[model samples]
Target: MFKRLRRLRLSSNIRELIKETRLDIRDFIYPLFAISGNGIKNEIPSMPGVYQMSPDVIVEECEQLKTLGIYHILLFGIPSHKDSCGSEALSDTGIVPKTIRAIKAKHPDITITADLCFCEYTDHGHCGIIDTKLKTVDNDATLEILAQQAVVLCSSGANIIAPSTMMDGMVWMIRNQLDKAGFSHIPIMSYSTKFSSAYYGPFREVAQSSPSFGDRKSYQEDPANRKEAILESLNDEAEGADILMVKPALAYLDIVRDIRERTLLPLAVYNVSGEYAMLKAAQTAGIIDYESVMIETMLSFKRAGADIIISYHAKEVAKYLLDRK
Candidate 1:
């Protein structure tokens, strides 16, 4: 008797029944860029369809996202001003905090995950304080600022604080500060194994956070190091991270799977802007089907063991899933 392995491939219904991995609308977390202004919804040139919206516009966008069944959003702020210490990130009236309050006031049901990093707030475009003399990011000083940012973000109604600085001991510091500030309920989603990659090129443009002088290689992990990635995730878990992330997901699915095996905490993978832009460019050139490729790429993340997917494609993915239903 011949083995009927082709039986499952015989029909679409059979394929769906045998599928081991599935993508859900709830698995996606959309990212938004919030700028300091009113009635602004400037599209990021490098990332098509992604915009830097004002607080009012952000609330409007969130309402739409809610209708699409995308309740979670990760916010990146572009302040109108910047300083050496990124003081605005800790200010009560800063762009992120102000945007948070606005979103909550209008849509209290949406969950906001604040991206806690100083790169956008600092004039130098580095993730943290710069040691002027040493010509490098001062890790300890950056930790202090990150902690303060976390508290302020939590106070402003952020349901989750995602620290993407890749600084050593940042998770512990933020966790400590949040508890001390009486925000013990807030969870920290640490970017545990962020790689230094060219894939972040488009993101730097959208966030206006490219380093003015040097690359982030000193702080972000090298893409070549697999063991180091796992170690980073382990350390963050020990430091009280509720969720751990592997950034630039397409190029690092192995790292995502490795980290997932090592920790019980939820794993999030960032499908960075460059990845989205590349696919968009391909589709525009008539080289591929945009919708089908987008769904396949997102399912790849889920197949690789990602519990949460943070992507610029979130809105599109949600719509596609809804259409399927």
Candidate 2:
């Protein structure tokens, strides 16, 4: 007798009942880009539906997201000013902190995860403090600044600090600083296995953080090294990361699965801008079914063992799931 798997696939109800992997609103962390202005919602050119919004607009967006049951968001800031030290990132009135306070004031129930990095705030467009003599990022100096940034974000009501710099010992540094500042409860989600990939092209435009001269290969992992990805997650875990992330999710599902097996800590995968852009371009060109592809892509992350997915697709995915319900 043939094992008829077709019985379960016969209808949507049966398929839903037996689906091994499912997408839930709670599994998503919507990413927002905040700029310094009022009433602004500038849609990113490459990322069609994504926008760079001002604080007031961000608050409105947060309220809407809350209504939709997408309780978590990851914020990236575009400060009005940029400097060598990314000083604005540590300011009480900086774009990110201001956006954080505004969102919390309006939607106190929402969880805000601030992206702790200097690239968008640095004039040089590098991730950290640069050593002119060495022509490389000064890792120790950047850690100190990251620690300060973490404290400021937590004080500004950020529920989580996601250090995306891929800096060495960054999780430990931020964790210690948070504890000393009486914010020991704030958890850290480290970008433990971010790769130096060509797939990051569109994100640079959205975040305005492309390096002015060189690439991020010095800090970010080489895309070719699978073993290194595992090591990176392990190191971040040892250094006090509450959650570990694999960036550019689609190309690195194996890495996501590998890291998931190695660590008991929660795993997050960043379905980055370029991944979103490619599908968006195809959808715009009528080359693929956007909704079907988007849902399938999100489910792949879940099937690969990602506990959390930070994606530009979060809002759409959440709405689609709600409609299905």
Estimate the TM-score of every prediction. 0.98, 0.97
Report the error of model 1 at residue 120, Å: 0.3
Q: Model 2 TM-score? A: 0.97
lDDT (C-alpha) at residue 293 in model 1: 94
Candidate 2 C-alpha error for residue 295, in Å: 0.6
Q: In model 2, which residue pairs have backbone atoms overlapping below 3 Å?
A: none
- Taking the tens digit of each residue's C-alpha lDDT, what string does model 2 give over 1-325? 2458667347977777778998888989999999999999999899999999999999999888987889999999998999999999999899999999999888889999999999999999998999999877899999999999999999999999999998898999999999999999989999999999999899899889889888889989999999998999999999999999999899999999999889999999999999999999999999999999999999999999999999999988988988988
Q: On residues 1-325, what C-alpha lDDT tens digit does candidate 1 reach at each position?
A: 2357667346888788878999998988999999988999999887889999999999999989998999999999999999888999989899999999999999999999999999999999999999989888999999998999899999999999999999999999999999999999999999999999999999999899988888899999999999998999999999999999999999999998998888899999999999999998998899999899999999899999999999999989988888989
What is the C-alpha local distance difference test score of each model? Answer: 0.93, 0.93
Q: Model 1 Cα displacement at 325 (Å)? A: 0.7
